[model samples]
Target: MEKDKWDKKITYPDLYLQFGSEERSFFKEEAKHLKAKYDELGSFCELKKFTGGHDYIKWNEEFVKTISKLLKT
Candidate 1:
């Protein structure tokens, strides 16, 4: 991975992330890194954690919530 690409300061669209409580450790770490990167770039980023694992039911619920948030914004 290119360090400059990852560290570049540029405009970015709003980000909304949904993670499950039982998600893999690697995924959680990646999410945290992304949040930090977005923050460093002065972009809007939200990370929401739910009490569930990687499944369709949880995904469906989070999808609806994400849509609602986007619509409201």
Candidate 2:
């Protein structure tokens, strides 16, 4: 992870975080916390929670959504 470099005064880009409701509580909580931190850091962050689990299928769907958003930017 590049987290070590995050505090180096580098410009941060906007981010999107997609998670599944069916994922473990710990996972969801962690994502939410990270989203909050990013939001406080003045980053455009979107956290989407969908009805699925932490599996490849959900990841694929999120990937598609992310790509679409990127294209719109």
The weakest ten consecutive residues by lDDT in model 1 span: 1-10
Predicted candidate 2 versus true structure: per-residue lDDT over 1-73, tens digit per residue:
2353344255468777888889999889878877776776777778888888898888888889899978999
Query: What does the lDDT read for residue 17 in candidate 2?
Result: 80
lDDT of each: 0.81, 0.78
Q: Estimate each model's TM-score.
A: 0.82, 0.76
Q: Point out where model 2 deviates above 4 Å.
A: 1-10
lDDT of 1 by residue, 10-53 (tens): 68888888788899987787778878888988888898888987
The backbone clash count of each candidate, in order, is 0, 0
